[model samples]
Target chain A: MSVSHPPGVHEPGILVLEVPGDLAAIEGVVDHVVEHCAPARLDRRRLLFNFRVGLTEAISNAILYGNAGDPDRRVLLELRAVPGEVRVRVSDQGGGFDPESVPDPRLPENLTLPDGRGVFLMRELMDEVRFNRAGNTVTLILREPGPAGAKIPEAVISTLEDFRTQLGLTLVAWTLAGERRVRVFPGGKVGGADAPEDPRPGSDAHGIAGTRRFRVPVGAGLAVEVEVAGHAAESPVARVLAAAVERSASLAREANRNRAALEAALEANRHIRLDMARERLSREMELAHDLQMKLLPPIPRLARVDAAARVVPAKSVGGDFYQVIQLSGGRVGVMIGDVSGHGFPAALIMALVMSAAAIYAEQGAAPAKVLEYVDRAIGDELESTEMYLSLCYCMLSPGFPDIAYANAGHPHAFVIGAGGEHRRLPATDPPMGIGAAPYGQSRIRWKPGEDLLLLFTDGLSDTLARTRRMSGEQQVLKTVEENRQRPSGEILGRLFELCDRATPSIPSDDRTAIVLRTR
Target chain B: MSFNMRRFGEVTLIEVAGQLIVGNRQELKRMILAEVEAGTRRFVVDFALTGYIDSSGLGILVSLSKKIREVGGRLRLASLNEDLRTLFELTKLDTLFEICSSREEALAE
Candidate 1:
């Protein structure tokens, strides 16, 4: 059905929300209604809660059963408010059904079914509920505390009426105008100037003889004053009325303070929500970091090679990985690689490369062929992420005097000879995913017992430069040359010590290092 | 890092200083992208004073280089200190763009 807006009817508090028929949109609608009630003078806790639940049920029914989850269909929620009452109408664009035909959901047989209960709950909870003639629209009306638009609360009026009946008070009323006093009770005015301008709770003579008067401040210039025509100022009935006026004023002051406190608490809740989101992000980063650390292979004690590797993650996860695989031919495969980028996305790509590299190296594939296999495996992933991985792999056989290696654009792979002479491995091919050119293998001389091989990622270079103010590659060469005769484990441990010394107070980028000493 | 741009003949020289990482890298991307969109494409990025750069920063430079190249323009890198050179080499990014030893070398070409 086509919707229409009748002009010239200016509602005091009107809200209209048009939402697609989706259950996921329920929370947003509920929050909107709850917030709308605060300014509509339905801020009392009980009234707000009842209105929220009632509205939720009404909207959910309209969206679920009435609209049947159709995206093309719409649910209309309109809230029209007077001073003390809110009339809500939720209508759905669907074929109508008879309200009388709906089975009673509270009966024993139908109580277990979820589909038939929302309308029953909405009717029972709200002050008044009715379905339109088409049965596709639900109207819910709720009246908050106090009579419809009554200035003084219903309780205050009833209390004063009790006083009037017990001792026949002639006038009892309130006015918010601070500087001037106008009589506004008993449906008319009977003024005798203002109440004595005293902010205390006591009585004095009204304009009429034998009548008593009392007024008390109700916060921000509003006051409640009572006048009894037949009672004297100090009489028992006048004293009772005086106590009741004081009680009403005190309640008003408490209510104002509570409203302020509620506002403060709401602001605090908003900040807490923001802090929670930040904390959750940090926690996720840490989890990704730990996952990357766990992916590094533990160094195994082979017959002739002592191997060690270390990866230090930054405050956020970084994309660096290393693996030491003992192959089938008494030959060992050692690899160090870095994926471009940081954080979870980079770390995830690093993990994929690590697993693919391990599987290829385990099959005793040549270093060049291993890189080719890995490149083909993650080719699409690298292209999609706009990133690549640089790798340096070496296959060392204990009996052979040469190490067969492949360089895939990794710059920090080093080979130290027996006399402490260092050889910098050059890039044989571009980094993975950058060039389709094939990987190339080369051979470098090494002393089985006295020489060591060292490989590193760029974070090591950045770390040394940031902390030691020294050349990154040079510092690493000096460390390796000095400890050439040491076992691979000790050299790797010492390198980690240096890294800790460099960044003592803060976590640095992911720094990976591998030292291989073949005896 | 902050960028200071100047014109040298047909080329736009963007001199960058300070550390380049994820947070401030977008500013560099915005400045270069704005220029590239305005049809000024012959560019040289001088990183002599740049102390550090992270993966995100590197990613932007790589994407920017490709963008400039796709527009039928050439982008060059000049005056990279040893540290940045090592970074480029490690990631094998040194092959992606033309590198010159100094800004004077870049201008001469």
Candidate 2:
């Protein structure tokens, strides 16, 4: 079949080949592409290298997988060439498999699998890889890249070459391409990128002691040594030559120093930006911390239930917040939460959750519904910030024997019995902002005058003690077990006291806890 | 902080010096990302000359590793000092990267 041409093919157009679905066709395609690509150019050489491998893999898959080893099948491979880039498309006639269903090759179990690594390699090697909805056609893009010091101009070096030609100099030596040292005569020729071609005449090992050479600092880790014949360092012509070379080198050195100084200034500016961001965050956190502290509802005076909560941040602000809201129909709602991170952002989130939860929980909303509302409200922010919060909110009403609660990844919620037997209020959903799974509500048996409900944040349980060890959740449970018979607020107070005594060092985090009991 | 780069076959060996802290994390990130954009697929970050690293530096490495992996490149680390070694272990990031004790091991085929 004849090669086809597509619209927008620039002069010296793209390459199209219709090759039979045979493995033998690979060598022919590689050779044809190499011939058409400009291998002499430095940037294009890099592009060619990447294209060779990516195209090989893509065409191999198209032939083997798409054609299913049928020699009669034809694979359509199209290569579109642009300035400093190449786009290739490979299509075949076959049913497609879901790319998503492909197992991760990095997993230990899949590591031994040989057949599935082709697509992974292609995606990794190429700059861009995309597939059509049908999944049979794959398009890949590759770009050219110049080396680190490619920005230095050729005009700057031509002046030295002109001076050398005028003086009948021996050779000019300089570092080129940020990789290799090059020596060139007054002879006019551009050095290739790969390596210095046509080495300058009489360029053998010459020590700098004997040669009347002028050392020129080219900066960016480069230096040029200009040596002349038939001239002493003190000669009038040689003196003039050395002055010119030194002046140029000094100018280049100044330029190089300015560049380094500019980079350093940029670095300093970045640090200043970072410091400013941090300072602004801390300042805002202090304000939000104060506001959130004020937003905390004082323990409600209820005839049927008694509740008390306290939150203390290790820094000026923290992620821990609590809500004690009086709901309609003689019901009482208690909530405690810990955002994933601390300081300004977490404090802001806590403040938002505090205000939103207060409004929703006081409207007699169900525990699950209140959590769902909060999740929806904060889901975008949580997703953007890549953080999540743990929450345990419960509703207790008069004559209702069970307390309905929704636990969103909160670990430290419990109901302690009069005999010091405590039961964990199980987590009913993945943490808010983690999963789309609906908030689940579960009820536990609640008894008046016989049971106490307790909730605490991880900062309390995770506090480091004198042992340089974490004061674990087990410690909190033990503390509550020791003081299960005490009133709700007194239990909280003693818990704080125990935390203070266990202070092996400074508390590195915020601590918040809530306790509730029926009168 | 400063970086020096050398090439061996498909891998670009980077020699990092000074402390990799918040002060220079962005510069480190830019250099690495520039290479990735330039089609360098394999990198070995040699930390033998490095003195210290904080959480910000660690965070930058993680981000760089993720971006490189997303583009089908691999980044290996070599010769971490005691402080860096402990920081990686403490943060459980030792599991996420391929860290070697010597340049030979990092460049192994």
Candidate 3:
């Protein structure tokens, strides 16, 4: 089976045999044909099972059924063994029969009758089965299941076919695996021609009698051999075809390696893109958290008032803020706000509100007027981002009997008396984004030098709700009542200490509280 | 193709190896039918080592199932690989046979 030739010599690729039409010859003929097909390099299992069984079935049918057991008749077996496929044709001398008339053996009723399964087995095992119109000649084709690394792409095959035709070659073949050759003909047909010599020497035939062969090494353990009509072994056309085959083979090998490398690179790029996106999001949140913390104004020193405010930022940046501004005419303005959402958007809104409140409150405007000015400054920003803030502003003056205040849906603002009694300054309007301009103003009775004004956001209370038996606001008020006689800074410290001791069940929000007293 | 046969209580278990095709399906049919004739009421065909089966192999299994059912016997198949299981599902034969995931489960049934 190892038929090796000199570099430029022609080698036969077809085998034809004739056997007597007898069932006894079926096994010997099938084995002989299979041995001739070794150059195709099919896998061992497929060669031993599928090809052997399919060829045996075809030969047996040609002998027993096609010839009707006639000893004088002959059956011709023509085998073509190429690089990737093997084709075998079995033709008998007897009259043909219709292949469609065979019953399907898989049917339940036909399952018990085992004689009708030959055609089914042949069709199942072989890659392709074709019958001539007369039905006497049946060709079975078996293909090699090439591994992915050894497969030549379709574009390279077509390119080589173009070069073969242009060079007036009768045949061009390349060794694939072992002695198996991938043959390409002049008209783009592969493995169809059994003869390479041209008898007619005309314009189309290129005035040649026999084929002149040239071989060139293309890759590792691979060579391309081309056959042209007449004695053109050293002609310019032979050299051109040799160079083209060498160039195309190298390009094909490079393309296969590049395609695999490109796929791996694309897979790695996908993971890196996802990781970078997550990293960018966390970095932006940290920057927003820094900006929100730095935007809060410090409590100013005053001759008639003691004020302290504290804010604990959550893991995710939130928009809870407090401001204490000393106004003209010896009055102090205290403001606290909680934005509706958390993140950079809410932090931006909080910054804008604090800046606007400070600008208007320092001008000695009333509590309602300051809120109206702040709302006008940031109303469109809140509406566009679909967020709002709960704000409470109170004005405290020396020797005043009551505190003038404006509450916009701020529920935690209260005036606590020295005797542990508390009064809530309820909402005068809805929150900023939902409430219209000209915000309502009100006054709560205040005992100067005897009352403490406490304001905190919902985040402070929600953190304490998990560990306290009573409501979170009631716990805060009781702690404040117990420490009412201490300095404002100490009272604020105790409130935060109580919150830090309680365990939280959920993600915490920004906690802010302000304690102010006018003496 | 080859198979191993064992008796677990009243059940006869046959483990088929390699490919069960037209070349060796008759041996499997004969082995199962002979056991049924000997008054064996239960059988389990384990396919843990079998890789492939063709149409003729499927045909022989159907005929054996019919014969075993006439004798009031039960036939169960177990441990089919993914490709074999899909083949049975595509042929709509999964419903006709009681299939189990493991050989022990088939023997327990």
Leading candidate by lDDT: 3
Better of 2 and 3 by TM-score: 2
Candidate DockQ scores, in order: 0.01, 0.03, 0.04
Task: For candidate 2, give the lDDT of residue A265.
Answer: 57
Which candidate gets the maximum DockQ versus the true structure? 3
The alpha-carbon deviation from the true structure for residue A318 of candidate 3, after best TM-score superposition, in angstroms, is 0.5
For model 1, residues A1-519, the per-residue Cα lDDT tens digits are 111122354444666555434454454455556556644576364354446556767776776678876644567776777666778878777776687787775455643332454555465546567676567777887754222333343345556767777766675554433233444454422222332233433333332243456554443324556666776657787777767766875786578568756754664554455345434545666787798888777987788888888887766667898888999978999999997665566777888888888999999999999988888888887775556779889999878988999989998998888888899888888988786547898988877887788999888877777666568888888888888778787888778788778777555457889998887
Mind giving the per-residue lDDT tens digits that candidate 2 earns over A1-519? Answer: 113333354445266555444353353455465555552233544344445556666776776677776543456666766555567777666665566676655565543333454565566556557665556667776643222223223544566676767766654444432223454433344333543433543233333455565555443334455566676545576567556655665676577657765655565454454344334434554576687678676887988787778987664455788888888887889999988664455666887788788889988889999898888788887765555789889999888788999999998899988888889999999888776447899999999778899899877877623333435677787778898887778888988887777674445567899989886
lDDT of 1 at B16: 82
- Candidate 1 residue B81 C-alpha distance from true site, Å: 36
What is the CAPRI rating of model 3's predicted complex? incorrect
Taking the tens digit of each residue's C-alpha lDDT, what string does model 1 give over B33-92?
Answer: 888888887899888877555444566677788788889888898998765675566445
DockQ of 1: 0.01
Rank order (by lDDT, best first): 3, 1, 2
lDDT of 3 by residue, A397-474 (tens): 877889899999998999999899999999999999889789999999998888999999998888888786988899
Candidate 1 runs further than 4 Å off: A1-271, B1-109
Q: Which model is ahead, 1 or 3, in terms of TM-score?
A: 1
- Against the true structure, candidate 3 reaches a TM-score of 0.42
- Candidate 3 has a DockQ of 0.04
Q: Score each candidate by Cα lDDT.
A: 0.69, 0.67, 0.74
